[model samples]
Target chain A: MKNVRLNALLAMGLIIVMILSLAAGKVWVSPAAWLGDDLSALIIMELRLPRTVLGAAIGAALGMAGATMQGYLRNPLADPGVFGVSASAALGAVTSLYFGYAVTAWLLPAFALAGAGIGMGLLALLAGRSGSLILFTLAGVILSSLAGSLTSLMISLAPTPFATTEIVTWLMGALTDRSWDDVQLAVPIIAAGMVFLFATGRSLDALTLGEDAARSMGVNISRLQWFAVLGVGLTVGASVAAAGIIGFVGLIVPHLVRPFAGHQPSAVLLPSALAGALLVVGADSIVRILPSVSELRLGIAMSLLGAPFFMALLFKMHRELS
Target chain B: MLLSFENLSLTLRGRKILDTISGQFQPGRVTVILGANGAGKSSLLSCLSGLREPKSGSVTLDDRALLSLNGKKRGRMIGLLPQRPDIHWNVDVRTIVGLGRLPHSGRWGMSAADHDAVARAMEATDCADLAERKAMRLSGGEQGRVLLARVLAGEPQWLLADEPLASLDPAHQFDVLERLKNYAAAGKGVIVVLHDLTQAARFADDIMVMKEGAILAAGPRNEVMTADIMAQAYGVEVQIGTSDTGEPLVVPVRRL
Candidate 1:
């Protein structure tokens, strides 16, 4: 009953924020513009609608992916970005921008999704059938470092200042000028990834007793690992592909919702996803309404918010330990 | 029905964990395995519960190969209470107990029978009152009982527990032993690994003593609980006495 109420409330919150996102941009589209075929309607449909949809989708993906990773690893600090999929996707987008392949609207996202797929493959290969958490985490760290270094190398090797600037700016991440094409590319993949994540809820719940007990309870540990990798890989990869590396949604949203959703990993998943959408859409609206010369990058905004929250979490854990 | 293992051996990182061993376990009996630290007792239990696979032997349940059974089927048949009662999440006790129903519960959710099993398990372990309490906040003894309840919630035909009484107080130890004995009396198989010989003697219908990856002695508790077997397996000189209730009381005099 509590979960139902929470889900409904979160869903309502997300809708409200999404509508505000559409209406609160630089040139506000009043109710009159929503139904009529005018310049304001054109602005709402062509620009804000797709951006709003992509923001919600990306946020949902990051949030659920974070919840799944945290649950599977049985670590509160686990996040989708920790797997290195988002970094690899960023590297792929950077590669496209560096080489000018992003001239085609679909090429960069395609490259990013491909990068995410390769990241998942490498994770699976490195972790193998051992299903050891230490091995999986180590593999993720290695992948992240490798991707980060490669992206740095690409930036350094760029022939012109323009390419470097473009790469750096995209890396900061935003929904600025994203179109319906971006929405069509990211939303379906995110939805598919969510299905894979939802499949892991029961197994993650069993894992609260630790791995051996979870396995004894009939959770095929290797299968669960595969699901987690694929789920996080696709979702985070697609989000990066659509909006660049938005950080902290996955990490912070689950922590926020866990209090209301209960401690069970399964219970936290849906609420985290909804709250994530609410958070990103709400944050995007705030950035737009804030009196800045240019809109703030969503990625930078999230990191600024997330870094402090991460520190606070560490302190809480430290207090508990001491 | 019978659960039997034949010539079972296991090697981990080039170290032999379990030597070639053969045994048959029957339902309606409480089998206690005893040994010194690093003996093969826990390893044997792991193999029995299908948590660890033996390298050179086969375990069968009612004439079918144990490993051949699907994980859910195997889980439904055998429940394991591991030595560690580590609950990674601070979930409520009922939620933790409900995890035992994972094998039996369908995709839709817990059925009425599943809920009843969880309730009954908590009742059996005397943790029903702690249902709403956070599992991580419980005392060691309370945690032990709640973990036992988690295993019992599965309602498995066979229960394999490793050091279920470790860190538990004497009262809770006796309570757990009594619960295992009562479970066996209800026609289920119960296999436990224990360090306390007196409690093992009081609770176990059959006893298996292990030494350095091999079974040193295994038989009816009266025959296997002799001073010589205890000395051989544990390297300790022991005094054996009978209690007023006619249970064997074993006390270690000194290390050999």
Candidate 2:
């Protein structure tokens, strides 16, 4: 019941924001922009439509990735941002770009996808081998910090300051000046990851009771872990490559949406996707509309709101532990 | 067709958790594994539940080898409730209970039969009243019962629980044990690893006393609960008395 209501609200909100995102941007194309009319087609089809779709797809992917990892590990704090998958993917994209490997738009995200695979591989080899989530979280902290420092060091050693600054902005995150090609690259990867993660919703639900019980219920623990890692890696990694490591979309969207979804991990999955799409769209729209903040990226908007949220979660966890 | 452990042995971190031991679990009878702390009771349960593979033995359910079966298939036949289950997310009680219905459901959603199973299991565990409550907000006993509902709803042929009553109050403890007792009476094989000798003696059709990674005694409760075997297993003297309900009640001398 709660799920039905929330899905309806989300569907409505998404439709409104999507319309606003396309219609209210700097181009200010008329309502006819949605149709394939030439002038409006150049603005809407050639630009805003693709951007809006990309934003929603990446948002849904990141949201589902975050939801899957948290659900599987049984920890709310296990987002790609906090655990470092985003930074790792960024490092991969930036390094590939630094090496002139991203001459094509597809190459950067493709390389970023590979980087996410590496990140997840390392995580599974270290974290999944353990029988406990606490151990996994600790391992993630160490790996993420190491990845962050390595990224910083690479940026410092970079030869061209112009490209270095670009990389930094990308790492900090953005969804600005993205072309239709960027949308084309992100849509399929995110869509695939979303499908796989959603397929395992029942498995994630069983896992919350812990591994032993989950296994007895016929959940292949190791295989399920691998699937979750794959889901998070592809979705989050693809998003990082496309949108430059947009922070908090994956973490906070699920936190807000899960309650209304009745806390069923499976129910949380798709709604999380919808909420994720909605958040990025809303954030991107804000970035486009705010007059003085034309330079503001979606990442900046989210960080402004998300940093306090990170602190709140930490404080809340501390209180709960106490 | 009974579940049996053949020459099961496990060594973890260079120490034997379960020394080479052999046992059989008869169908339609409850096997209660009773032992003191550090006596490897939990490890034994883990082996049977396929959470941990025995280093040098096999767990067989009928003609099928548990070690060979994947986690999903084995889980269908074996319902296990481990000690101290914790939730990372705040989910509804019914949602948690519905998890037991996973083995019966497909990827897209649960069927009507699955929902019916959830409702019936919740009703059986006395958690239907609290179905709308958040799982993390429930009392430890309530959470435990909810998990029991989750396990019970799975309807596995063999139910293995490690210290199911460890944190429950007396009334809840009775509630949980009686449910297990009823499950066994219905011709399901239920193995409860317990520390409370009195509960084991009263409810177990068959009891095995484990000590030092091996079985000290194994038989019907009357045959297995001799004072000497209890002393060896628990490292204390046990005095047996009859309850008002004519079940065995155990009193242990304090270890000073």
Candidate 3:
């Protein structure tokens, strides 16, 4: 399929999913009720609209970040979380929850963003000037392990069971009861990060020829590295701040869209973004409509699906290698 | 125009890779660098292509410092086909070849002229029939041709290739050497590093022999392709003779 047509299809799919997200909850609100000044209209406007918008923004951010990472690293297994930004951001949010500072709503996200910034700074310090892929990947692994251990430590040391519950629940990731405040805080940041990721498309295309050839082709390796770090940090950090650690969207979306994009790194970016938004909003809607006591957490839902998909991907790669 | 370097030296990890090498490469000629392993042949090509900066010397293109030129301008002037070039994705051959136009492309994407260049490059390399095939799925020889077409698409004033025929069959090796020779014939500077002495002697307009990070011999091929130079540079007893077509051949007889 033509990239333009594929993009259009993805955009159309996203619009449908967004509408479903705005309407699918415990109490179903028809599209007609979304207009008038009544309880249904209030429900749609006050609650579901913000949640849907936030879901789309977070998904787009993660999707674009994933595509950028995979292209920059030239590894299909790479994702935004591989950079440790998401885990560090989660640690920051957990820290706020552990200290009971999350009651302010803004403090948690602020801490998460701060955590992401520190992770990015550390990454730049470790891998920035060298522009070596192995070094950058190893630094990310170390950062991820460190951040994960710290989060676990915070969980074990929670003062009360209730605090532990809150931290654990938030860490599972969801867009439940998210308001316009969350949307306002995260959307602009994710948009800004997307701009950075978008700028890397051409450079990523150059990188498919390997680092030496890329440099020969006028790609400034250090500059491209900085852009990848900044872009992934902001987008993944903001998504974690707003929606917790949503995994697999970045990893899976690019792969899903690559064939349609002619397998070009630059061509894969936009379609991945759109498909990511579609997947998240669609998944969130399914979780909302499930007949469970409480709505399933989106992060856990993604993991349940993503882990199996990951295994399948590994198997496929094994076959190809053999 | 001349692509020349002066007193170029490079040291990596406390080991000297290039030791104050100086040479001038003329346009419209195929200059082949021959050496043993670790003889700085590849490193010299890296310096000449602006892929590596020499420690304390200069590379100049037409009297302007090569390193001082911006990456895009330098890329437009010189294209390097590295040894073991990898196509990391499953992209088609046309797209792979089109990447050579990156340094000349504008923000909006490939121009009409850029497409023409890509087409011409594919035609020249005889890979137009493989344009729609996935690059990674092609045979080694086909992939090499596609990569060469990629460099040609850039239409740079200088082309430097390091062991471009490494993994190809003998037939494909001749094919690549002929392409390089034709490219130089069309008035672009061509520099290649080759381990095969006979191939170098057959294809090179000028020959440079390097040993232990220094040039052992360099001049017109007829002046430099000698048994004494081969023994000095490669530490091998060699027989230099002419083929039926009157092309020179260097056959290694024994270890020194």
TM-score leaderboard ranking: 3, 1, 2
* Interface RMSD over true interface Cα atoms for each candidate: 1.3, 2.3, 2.1
Off by over 4 Å in 2: A33-40, A128-134, A316-322, B243-246, B254-256
lDDT of 3 at B219: 94
Q: Provide the global lDDT of candidate 3 against the true structure.
A: 0.89
Q: Model 1: per-residue lDDT, tens digit, A1-322?
A: 2499999999998998888899988877876678788888888999889999999999999999889878877778777576687888899889999899999987888788778768866876886344466788898889999999999999999989999998998899898999998899889889998999999999989989988899888999889887887787788888998899998898899999988888899999999999999999999888888889988999999999998998999899989999
Q: For candidate 3, lDDT tens digit of each residue in A57-161? A: 999998998898888878787776766878899999999999999999779878987888688768768864455667888988899999999999999999999
Which prediction has the highest DockQ against the true structure? 1
- Give Cα-based local distance difference scores for all models: 0.89, 0.83, 0.89
In angstroms, how far off is A179's CA in candidate 1? Answer: 0.5
Per-residue lDDT of candidate 3, residues B176-233 (tens digit): 9999999999999999999898899899999999999999989999899998898898
Better of 2 and 3 by TM-score: 3
User: Which pairs, if any, clash in model 2?
Assistant: A216-B75, A218-B72
Interface DockQ of each model: 0.72, 0.67, 0.66
- Please report, as a value between 0 and 1, the fraction of native contacts recovered by candidate 3: 0.79
**Which regions of candidate 3 are displaced past 4 Å?**
A99-107, A117-142, A159-162
State every prediction's TM-score relative to the real structure. 0.96, 0.94, 0.96
The per-residue C-alpha lDDT of model 2 at residue A186 equals: 83
